[model samples]
Target: MIYLAIGFPPAAKSCAYRMRETANNFVALGWDVTVLTIAEESWEREYGLDHTLSDAVDPRVRIVELPLAREDLATDIREFTEERALNPTRWSKQERERHLEHFPELVFGGWRSALEQGLLDIHREFPADLLLASCAPYVNLAAAWKLWEEHQVPYAIDFRDGWSVDVIGGGEAFTRDSEAGRWEEKVLAEAVAVWCVNDPIADFYRERYPRLAERVHVVRNGFDSDSVPAAHGAPNAEDGLTFGYLGSVNFKPEFLATVLDGWRAARERDPLLARSRFEIRGHIGAGASREANAHMALIRQAESDGVVFGGPVAKAEVAATYGRWDALVLMLVGGRFVTSGKVYEFMASGLPVVSAHEVDHDASAVLTGHPLWTGACGLDAAGLADSFVEAARMAVEATAEQRAEARAHANRFDRGLLMAPAARQLADTVRPALLTGSTQG
Candidate 1:
């Protein structure tokens, strides 16, 4: 079996971890697997690849890198088109419209031809038994559909987040008549199975494609135990309290501003917070925005409040970086449908978490009973101020028993263990089909 996964992965973000685990799982299942994805230089422009994530990939798995690139993530000024650099916001708006002309998805629609051609080429050479398409770029589905239309290779979709369902706002993201809608319905129509990260997302797919209700499966994201440090406790902050956040700063500037305001408010209200430091580690706007974006400016403005905007940290340093933190700040977008991979790792961190997101978010569902969690509240300065205070208390007072129980809660979400059953089911479905095809060929 071969997988067509085109997530802008290993830029030290949520999707990369899942993609790595999925590829690893496929290889461990005693099947030769080939992974088709974009180039390393492309990743450098987007999230900046952490080769550490690829360390665990099975030696047997073949990774075929395409020359494809996401034009949006481009960073170097020398490579920039004069039009893109001068008026990036206007240029991006125009880019989206241009993409919508091809297909509804902006970053992905342009990728369709390249992905289809790549998959077809790979198939011609190796003659794959089964195909798996994971999306975010959604372009992978087009390639999967193209191959299946021509070759009838049974394929599955890892829809980590439902395309039609708006996880952030909790509603239909696009109308059925939309290009992406038509593409999703058509592509998923023949897919052997579809995987979603949470129940709500699965339910959305089932409701949207009632005929394919039986095919949708909920495969929650789980933590890799190796990503957490051996020692389980906050660093003593005699010098200063350290709060860390690891994820993209893709949310609205107002949203980012709210969190920064809250951090400032907390620092003003509490002596402990005043002496504390917040370190944000992740990619900001790619391409021209880079450090020039409003989010980076906001973090820079909060420097007086002890906020540090360290550019993206590599996956190899994830555990070590977390080791220095006194608490976790869960700044997320989206509502009930979003079950970001970071939340699971945060649960395993044994550190107090201050969630700055919608109160009804799916992350709140997972962290509900966590001993050190401060709980979710929409991004409001006042609310976040209270959460920061609560998180400080939790960190100051949390016991060994509490930490052990928190780790136990996350134990159910170990990456390999959670993915094992799903891998088994996929292998079972693909093996028979693969054997039948080979015998016929």
Candidate 2:
């Protein structure tokens, strides 16, 4: 089966790793997998590349690159229109409306013809038995639907975050009459299966389309074992304790400011934390903002507070960096349904975790039983300040047994174990149909 996945390996997005692992697992099960995705240059402009991630991809799987790009994520100043450069927010809003008019997809609507043609070409060379379409842009469903309409090949949809539900804002993303909602309904109506990352999202799909409830699967994102270092490794003994925050810096400046303020407050109260260092590693902005954004400025302000923004780290350095960290600060942006991929990795690191997200995020569901988790109350400066101090206390006082239990909680989410059954389910769903057709023949 050829996977119609657009966020395949080396895209640097969190979904890329999951896509790669899924593809590799399929290959291991003796299936030829072809990953359809945008070009590496497209990813570079959006989130940059980490070729080291490609090392884990089964060499047997083929990757087909689409000549598509997310203009919003573009970094090249030469390519930016003067109007867009002057007022990017307004320009992007207009661009999205224009896209909806044509194809009902915003970031990916324009890829309709490109994706259609790409699918056609792939089918012509090697007919696909099934098409597994993953989405965020939601345009992938269009391509997968096109294949189903044209070739009758069974397809599945992986909605990491539910399309119609606003996980962050907690409301309907769009009405049923709207273009995006209409498109979602139409495409999902024909899909054989749907996959959501968390239970809330899966429940959304079930409530939205009751008949398709059985098809929606919850496939949790798990940390890659190789991305975690041994507990025996020593941290920085001479300089100071390192508290790490790693993930894309896509949250609001006010939110980041609150976290920084909290860090400052914690430093003022706790002697150990006052002398410690905070290192944040991740992408900030692309295009014109680059390093000239308010987020960068805020991070710079915290430099005097022993806070250092270290930019993006390569995939190879993920484990080693975690090993050197004394504790972790999980700064996230969403409530209830939002369970980030980073939470699993952070939990697996066996370090004290301080949450900087909404009080009711889905991540809280995973970390609730964890002894070292400080817990998410809110992102208020003062509240977060208290939370940080509590986390520091936990870091210093947490027992070895507690750390071991934290790792044990994460052990249930090993990617291979979680995905193996899901993959087996996919195979099981497809096999009976193949056999029935054979018998009829």
Candidate maximizing lDDT: 2
State the C-alpha lDDT per candidate. Answer: 0.82, 0.84
What lDDT is reached at residue 378 by model 2? 88
TM-score of each: 0.93, 0.94
Model 2 C-alpha lDDT versus the unseen true structure: 0.84
- Candidate 1 per-residue C-alpha lDDT over 1-441 given as tens digits, one digit per residue, 9 for 90 to 100: 778876534444567778778878878878778888888777666656787777776777788888887677666668778998899898888877776665667876877788889999999999887788888887778788888888887889998897889888889999888777888898888888899999999999999999999989999898888878664664454666888998788889999889889988988898888899899988888765777888888888888989998887777788888887878998888888987888998998888899998988899999989888887778789999999988877777788788888788888889888888998897787677566654211
Candidate 2 TM-score to native: 0.94
Candidate 1, run of 10 with poorest lDDT = 432-441
Q: Which residue pairs come into collision in candidate 1? A: 74-287, 168-334
Could you say which candidate leads in TM-score? 2
lDDT of 2 by residue, 15-54 (tens): 8878988898888887788888888888776677889889
RMSD (CA, Å), each prediction: 2.5, 2.4
Rate residue 234 of model 2 by lDDT: 36
